[model samples]
Target: DTRKVAVFVGSLRKDSFNRQLARALERLGEDRLEFDHVEIGGLPFYDQDFDEDYPAEGVALKQQVRAADAVLFVTPEYNRSVPGVLKNAIDLASRPYGDSAFAGLPAAVIGASPGAIGTAMAQQHLRNILSYLDMAVLPQPEAYLQFKDGLIDDEGRVTNQDTREFLEDFVDGFVEWIDRQRG
Candidate 1:
Protein backbone atom coordinates (compact mmCIF):
# COMPACT_ATOMS: atom_id res chain seq x y z
CA ASP A 1 0.00 0.00 0.00
CA THR A 2 1.10 3.57 -0.65
CA ARG A 3 1.35 6.15 2.09
CA LYS A 4 0.18 9.70 1.64
CA VAL A 5 2.72 12.30 2.76
CA ALA A 6 1.67 15.90 3.36
CA VAL A 7 4.55 18.15 2.29
CA PHE A 8 4.71 21.60 3.85
CA VAL A 9 6.97 24.06 2.11
CA GLY A 10 7.87 26.93 4.43
CA SER A 11 8.87 29.40 1.80
CA LEU A 12 6.30 31.22 -0.29
CA ARG A 13 8.84 32.23 -2.91
CA LYS A 14 8.19 30.78 -6.36
CA ASP A 15 11.76 29.56 -6.74
CA SER A 16 12.71 28.57 -3.21
CA PHE A 17 15.51 26.08 -2.70
CA ASN A 18 13.49 24.32 -0.03
CA ARG A 19 10.69 23.80 -2.51
CA GLN A 20 13.13 22.33 -4.99
CA LEU A 21 14.45 20.03 -2.28
CA ALA A 22 10.92 18.89 -1.58
CA ARG A 23 10.41 18.06 -5.25
CA ALA A 24 13.60 16.05 -5.23
CA LEU A 25 12.40 14.07 -2.25
CA GLU A 26 9.11 13.45 -4.06
CA ARG A 27 10.98 12.08 -7.02
CA LEU A 28 12.95 9.77 -4.76
CA GLY A 29 9.83 8.50 -2.98
CA GLU A 30 7.65 8.04 -6.08
CA ASP A 31 7.41 4.28 -5.77
CA ARG A 32 6.07 3.88 -2.24
CA LEU A 33 4.68 7.27 -1.31
CA GLU A 34 2.23 9.77 -2.74
CA PHE A 35 3.00 13.41 -2.05
CA ASP A 36 0.67 16.38 -1.65
CA HIS A 37 2.04 19.89 -1.23
CA VAL A 38 -0.08 21.55 1.43
CA GLU A 39 -0.23 25.28 0.82
CA ILE A 40 0.62 27.40 3.86
CA GLY A 41 1.21 30.65 2.01
CA GLY A 42 -2.44 31.70 2.27
CA LEU A 43 -3.12 30.60 5.82
CA PRO A 44 -3.81 33.51 8.13
CA PHE A 45 -1.92 33.96 11.34
CA TYR A 46 -3.27 31.61 14.01
CA ASP A 47 -5.57 32.99 16.61
CA GLN A 48 -7.05 31.25 19.65
CA ASP A 49 -10.28 33.24 19.34
CA PHE A 50 -11.00 31.53 16.03
CA ASP A 51 -10.33 28.02 17.23
CA GLU A 52 -13.99 27.09 17.36
CA ASP A 53 -14.76 28.85 14.13
CA TYR A 54 -11.68 28.15 12.09
CA PRO A 55 -11.33 29.83 8.72
CA ALA A 56 -11.86 27.79 5.59
CA GLU A 57 -8.17 27.78 4.78
CA GLY A 58 -7.28 26.73 8.28
CA VAL A 59 -9.92 24.02 8.29
CA ALA A 60 -8.73 22.69 4.97
CA LEU A 61 -5.17 22.68 6.24
CA LYS A 62 -6.23 20.76 9.34
CA GLN A 63 -8.14 18.27 7.26
CA GLN A 64 -5.13 17.70 5.09
CA VAL A 65 -2.91 17.20 8.11
CA ARG A 66 -5.30 14.75 9.72
CA ALA A 67 -5.74 12.72 6.55
CA ALA A 68 -2.07 12.24 5.86
CA ASP A 69 -0.11 9.13 6.85
CA ALA A 70 3.00 11.24 7.40
CA VAL A 71 4.28 14.84 7.26
CA LEU A 72 7.36 16.22 5.55
CA PHE A 73 8.50 19.72 6.47
CA VAL A 74 10.66 21.56 3.96
CA THR A 75 11.59 24.76 5.73
CA PRO A 76 13.94 27.70 5.38
CA GLU A 77 15.69 29.51 8.19
CA TYR A 78 14.87 33.09 8.97
CA ASN A 79 16.83 34.78 11.73
CA ARG A 80 18.12 31.37 12.80
CA SER A 81 14.65 29.89 13.27
CA VAL A 82 11.60 28.70 11.38
CA PRO A 83 9.66 31.23 9.36
CA GLY A 84 6.54 32.74 10.94
CA VAL A 85 4.29 31.22 8.28
CA LEU A 86 5.24 27.63 9.14
CA LYS A 87 5.01 28.31 12.87
CA ASN A 88 1.60 29.80 12.32
CA ALA A 89 0.43 26.73 10.45
CA ILE A 90 1.73 24.52 13.22
CA ASP A 91 -0.11 26.56 15.78
CA LEU A 92 -3.26 26.49 13.70
CA ALA A 93 -3.23 22.71 13.32
CA SER A 94 -2.33 22.23 17.00
CA ARG A 95 -5.29 23.91 18.51
CA PRO A 96 -8.61 23.51 20.42
CA TYR A 97 -6.79 22.21 23.47
CA GLY A 98 -5.62 18.60 23.00
CA ASP A 99 -7.09 18.13 19.53
CA SER A 100 -3.85 18.67 17.66
CA ALA A 101 -3.90 17.03 14.21
CA PHE A 102 -0.20 16.30 14.41
CA ALA A 103 -0.29 14.28 17.58
CA GLY A 104 1.47 10.92 17.10
CA LEU A 105 2.03 11.47 13.39
CA PRO A 106 5.26 10.32 11.76
CA ALA A 107 7.29 13.27 10.49
CA ALA A 108 10.60 14.24 8.90
CA VAL A 109 12.32 17.59 8.26
CA ILE A 110 14.70 18.74 5.54
CA GLY A 111 15.74 22.09 4.15
CA ALA A 112 18.04 23.82 1.70
CA SER A 113 19.77 27.19 1.95
CA PRO A 114 22.42 29.26 0.22
CA GLY A 115 24.15 29.78 3.55
CA ALA A 116 26.72 27.57 5.19
CA ILE A 117 24.39 26.53 8.04
CA GLY A 118 21.95 25.13 5.49
CA THR A 119 18.93 25.67 7.74
CA ALA A 120 20.31 23.55 10.59
CA MET A 121 19.09 25.96 13.19
CA ALA A 122 15.67 26.18 11.62
CA GLN A 123 15.29 22.41 11.57
CA GLN A 124 16.36 22.23 15.21
CA HIS A 125 13.75 24.79 16.15
CA LEU A 126 11.11 22.90 14.20
CA ARG A 127 12.14 19.65 15.90
CA ASN A 128 11.52 21.20 19.28
CA ILE A 129 8.11 22.39 18.21
CA LEU A 130 7.19 19.05 16.67
CA SER A 131 8.27 17.33 19.85
CA TYR A 132 5.76 19.46 21.72
CA LEU A 133 3.11 18.34 19.23
CA ASP A 134 4.13 14.70 19.88
CA MET A 135 5.21 13.76 16.36
CA ALA A 136 7.36 10.67 15.87
CA VAL A 137 10.16 12.33 13.90
CA LEU A 138 13.01 10.49 12.26
CA PRO A 139 16.21 11.04 14.25
CA GLN A 140 18.96 10.15 11.83
CA PRO A 141 20.23 11.17 8.42
CA GLU A 142 19.29 14.78 8.97
CA ALA A 143 19.28 16.65 5.63
CA TYR A 144 20.48 20.24 5.72
CA LEU A 145 21.19 20.86 2.07
CA GLN A 146 23.50 23.72 1.12
CA PHE A 147 22.35 25.18 -2.15
CA LYS A 148 24.74 26.25 -4.85
CA ASP A 149 23.97 27.50 -8.33
CA GLY A 150 22.89 24.61 -10.55
CA LEU A 151 22.47 22.30 -7.58
CA ILE A 152 19.00 21.61 -8.90
CA ASP A 153 18.08 21.56 -12.56
CA ASP A 154 15.03 23.07 -14.22
CA GLU A 155 13.40 19.62 -14.28
CA GLY A 156 13.34 19.48 -10.44
CA ARG A 157 16.18 17.02 -10.22
CA VAL A 158 19.09 17.16 -7.82
CA THR A 159 22.15 17.63 -10.01
CA ASN A 160 24.90 17.20 -7.46
CA GLN A 161 25.86 13.55 -7.27
CA ASP A 162 26.75 13.66 -3.58
CA THR A 163 23.56 15.47 -2.63
CA ARG A 164 21.53 13.14 -4.79
CA GLU A 165 23.00 10.04 -3.13
CA PHE A 166 22.54 11.47 0.32
CA LEU A 167 18.95 12.48 -0.35
CA GLU A 168 18.20 9.03 -1.78
CA ASP A 169 19.53 7.46 1.40
CA PHE A 170 17.63 9.97 3.49
CA VAL A 171 14.33 9.25 1.77
CA ASP A 172 14.99 5.51 2.03
CA GLY A 173 15.49 5.84 5.74
CA PHE A 174 12.36 7.96 6.03
CA VAL A 175 10.30 5.38 4.13
CA GLU A 176 11.64 2.62 6.35
CA TRP A 177 10.78 4.58 9.44
CA ILE A 178 7.28 5.23 8.19
CA ASP A 179 6.81 1.52 7.45
CA ARG A 180 8.04 0.55 10.88
CA GLN A 181 5.67 3.04 12.45
CA ARG A 182 2.84 1.67 10.35
CA GLY A 183 3.57 -1.80 11.68
Candidate 2:
Protein backbone atom coordinates (compact mmCIF):
# COMPACT_ATOMS: atom_id res chain seq x y z
CA ASP A 1 0.00 0.00 0.00
CA THR A 2 1.11 3.54 -0.67
CA ARG A 3 0.63 6.52 1.63
CA LYS A 4 0.96 10.22 1.01
CA VAL A 5 3.05 12.40 3.33
CA ALA A 6 3.21 16.15 3.67
CA VAL A 7 6.76 17.27 4.21
CA PHE A 8 7.27 20.63 5.90
CA VAL A 9 10.65 22.21 5.49
CA GLY A 10 10.84 24.66 8.34
CA SER A 11 13.64 26.88 7.12
CA LEU A 12 13.22 29.68 4.60
CA ARG A 13 16.76 29.73 3.30
CA LYS A 14 17.63 28.26 -0.05
CA ASP A 15 20.84 26.80 1.38
CA SER A 16 19.29 25.55 4.60
CA PHE A 17 20.74 22.30 5.87
CA ASN A 18 17.35 21.30 7.22
CA ARG A 19 15.87 21.62 3.74
CA GLN A 20 18.64 19.41 2.44
CA LEU A 21 17.76 16.82 5.02
CA ALA A 22 14.13 16.96 3.95
CA ARG A 23 15.15 16.40 0.36
CA ALA A 24 17.20 13.39 1.38
CA LEU A 25 14.28 11.94 3.29
CA GLU A 26 12.08 12.38 0.24
CA ARG A 27 14.54 10.42 -1.86
CA LEU A 28 14.62 7.58 0.63
CA GLY A 29 10.82 7.40 0.73
CA GLU A 30 10.22 7.81 -2.99
CA ASP A 31 9.77 4.10 -3.52
CA ARG A 32 7.13 3.56 -0.85
CA LEU A 33 5.41 6.88 -0.21
CA GLU A 34 4.10 9.99 -1.88
CA PHE A 35 6.11 12.95 -0.65
CA ASP A 36 4.43 16.34 -1.00
CA HIS A 37 6.10 19.41 0.47
CA VAL A 38 4.54 22.79 1.20
CA GLU A 39 6.45 26.03 1.35
CA ILE A 40 6.02 28.19 4.46
CA GLY A 41 7.91 31.32 3.56
CA GLY A 42 5.01 33.06 1.84
CA LEU A 43 2.50 32.44 4.60
CA PRO A 44 1.31 35.49 6.41
CA PHE A 45 1.55 35.76 10.17
CA TYR A 46 -1.23 33.70 11.72
CA ASP A 47 -4.38 35.70 12.30
CA GLN A 48 -7.63 34.46 13.79
CA ASP A 49 -9.61 36.97 11.78
CA PHE A 50 -8.70 35.25 8.58
CA ASP A 51 -10.25 31.97 9.62
CA GLU A 52 -13.27 32.77 7.48
CA ASP A 53 -11.26 32.81 4.29
CA TYR A 54 -7.87 31.36 4.87
CA PRO A 55 -5.08 32.54 2.62
CA ALA A 56 -4.76 30.59 -0.59
CA GLU A 57 -1.50 29.09 0.51
CA GLY A 58 -2.81 28.16 3.96
CA VAL A 59 -5.84 26.51 2.48
CA ALA A 60 -3.65 24.59 0.09
CA LEU A 61 -1.34 23.55 2.89
CA LYS A 62 -4.20 22.33 5.03
CA GLN A 63 -5.63 20.41 2.13
CA GLN A 64 -2.30 18.76 1.46
CA VAL A 65 -1.85 17.70 5.08
CA ARG A 66 -5.41 16.50 5.34
CA ALA A 67 -4.87 14.32 2.29
CA ALA A 68 -1.68 12.83 3.63
CA ASP A 69 -1.30 10.04 6.17
CA ALA A 70 1.58 11.72 7.95
CA VAL A 71 3.85 14.74 8.11
CA LEU A 72 7.60 15.16 8.25
CA PHE A 73 9.15 18.30 9.72
CA VAL A 74 12.69 19.31 8.96
CA THR A 75 13.52 22.42 10.93
CA PRO A 76 16.37 24.52 12.23
CA GLU A 77 16.91 26.05 15.66
CA TYR A 78 16.28 29.76 15.92
CA ASN A 79 17.03 31.24 19.35
CA ARG A 80 16.35 27.90 21.04
CA SER A 81 12.90 27.52 19.53
CA VAL A 82 11.15 26.53 16.34
CA PRO A 83 11.28 29.15 13.64
CA GLY A 84 8.36 31.56 13.59
CA VAL A 85 7.54 30.64 10.01
CA LEU A 86 7.24 26.97 10.86
CA LYS A 87 5.13 27.65 13.92
CA ASN A 88 2.98 29.92 11.84
CA ALA A 89 2.34 27.15 9.38
CA ILE A 90 1.40 24.83 12.20
CA ASP A 91 -1.01 27.37 13.56
CA LEU A 92 -2.52 27.75 10.14
CA ALA A 93 -3.12 24.03 9.86
CA SER A 94 -4.54 23.89 13.37
CA ARG A 95 -7.53 26.08 12.85
CA PRO A 96 -11.37 26.34 13.00
CA TYR A 97 -11.18 25.09 16.62
CA GLY A 98 -12.05 21.45 15.89
CA ASP A 99 -10.98 20.95 12.30
CA SER A 100 -7.24 21.15 12.51
CA ALA A 101 -5.44 19.64 9.56
CA PHE A 102 -2.90 18.20 11.96
CA ALA A 103 -5.39 16.44 14.16
CA GLY A 104 -4.32 12.89 15.03
CA LEU A 105 -1.66 12.83 12.36
CA PRO A 106 1.28 10.49 12.78
CA ALA A 107 4.14 12.96 12.52
CA ALA A 108 7.88 13.14 12.95
CA VAL A 109 10.26 16.02 13.65
CA ILE A 110 13.88 16.19 12.56
CA GLY A 111 16.02 19.23 13.30
CA ALA A 112 19.34 20.43 11.98
CA SER A 113 21.56 23.28 13.12
CA PRO A 114 25.05 24.48 12.61
CA GLY A 115 25.42 24.63 16.38
CA ALA A 116 26.67 21.77 18.47
CA ILE A 117 23.28 20.95 19.99
CA GLY A 118 21.91 20.46 16.49
CA THR A 119 18.58 22.15 17.07
CA ALA A 120 17.77 20.01 20.13
CA MET A 121 16.14 22.93 21.87
CA ALA A 122 14.08 23.81 18.83
CA GLN A 123 12.92 20.23 18.40
CA GLN A 124 11.84 20.19 22.02
CA HIS A 125 9.91 23.37 21.48
CA LEU A 126 8.08 21.81 18.54
CA ARG A 127 7.34 18.71 20.59
CA ASN A 128 5.44 20.81 23.09
CA ILE A 129 3.15 22.20 20.39
CA LEU A 130 2.67 18.82 18.74
CA SER A 131 1.62 17.48 22.10
CA TYR A 132 -1.42 19.74 22.15
CA LEU A 133 -2.04 19.13 18.46
CA ASP A 134 -2.32 15.39 19.22
CA MET A 135 0.27 14.37 16.68
CA ALA A 136 2.02 11.07 17.35
CA VAL A 137 5.71 11.83 16.99
CA LEU A 138 8.33 9.19 16.38
CA PRO A 139 10.38 8.89 19.55
CA GLN A 140 13.52 7.01 18.63
CA PRO A 141 16.53 7.33 16.33
CA GLU A 142 16.34 11.07 16.64
CA ALA A 143 18.28 12.92 13.96
CA TYR A 144 20.23 16.03 14.97
CA LEU A 145 22.62 17.12 12.28
CA GLN A 146 25.64 19.00 13.58
CA PHE A 147 28.11 21.24 11.80
CA LYS A 148 30.08 18.74 9.84
CA ASP A 149 31.92 20.45 7.04
CA GLY A 150 31.45 18.86 3.63
CA LEU A 151 28.60 16.67 4.85
CA ILE A 152 26.49 18.78 2.51
CA ASP A 153 28.07 19.27 -0.88
CA ASP A 154 28.21 22.48 -2.92
CA GLU A 155 24.99 21.39 -4.60
CA GLY A 156 23.37 21.21 -1.15
CA ARG A 157 22.77 17.49 -1.35
CA VAL A 158 23.74 15.34 1.61
CA THR A 159 27.22 14.14 0.62
CA ASN A 160 28.52 12.28 3.60
CA GLN A 161 28.29 8.52 3.18
CA ASP A 162 27.68 7.71 6.84
CA THR A 163 24.91 10.28 7.33
CA ARG A 164 23.22 9.23 4.11
CA GLU A 165 23.08 5.61 5.28
CA PHE A 166 21.59 6.62 8.58
CA LEU A 167 18.97 8.78 6.87
CA GLU A 168 17.99 5.83 4.69
CA ASP A 169 17.24 3.80 7.78
CA PHE A 170 15.49 6.73 9.36
CA VAL A 171 13.19 7.07 6.36
CA ASP A 172 12.35 3.38 6.64
CA GLY A 173 11.53 3.82 10.29
CA PHE A 174 9.32 6.77 9.49
CA VAL A 175 7.43 4.80 6.86
CA GLU A 176 6.94 1.92 9.27
CA TRP A 177 5.79 4.25 11.96
CA ILE A 178 3.23 5.76 9.63
CA ASP A 179 1.98 2.30 8.75
CA ARG A 180 1.68 1.28 12.37
CA GLN A 181 -0.18 4.42 13.24
CA ARG A 182 -2.59 3.89 10.40
CA GLY A 183 -3.04 0.24 11.32
- Candidate topping lDDT: 1
The global C-alpha lDDT for each of the candidates, from Candidate 1 onward, is 0.91, 0.85
| Candidate 1 lDDT over residue span 78-183, tens digit each | 9999999999989988887788889999999999899998999999999999999999999989988889988888777888888899999999989998888878
Error of 1 at 148 (Å): 0.6
TM-score of predicted structure 1: 0.97
Q: 167 in model 2: Cα distance from truth in Å?
A: 1.3
Top TM-score hit: 1
Residue 56, candidate 1: alpha-carbon lDDT:
82
lDDT of 2 by residue, 34-63 (tens): 888887888888899878877887788789
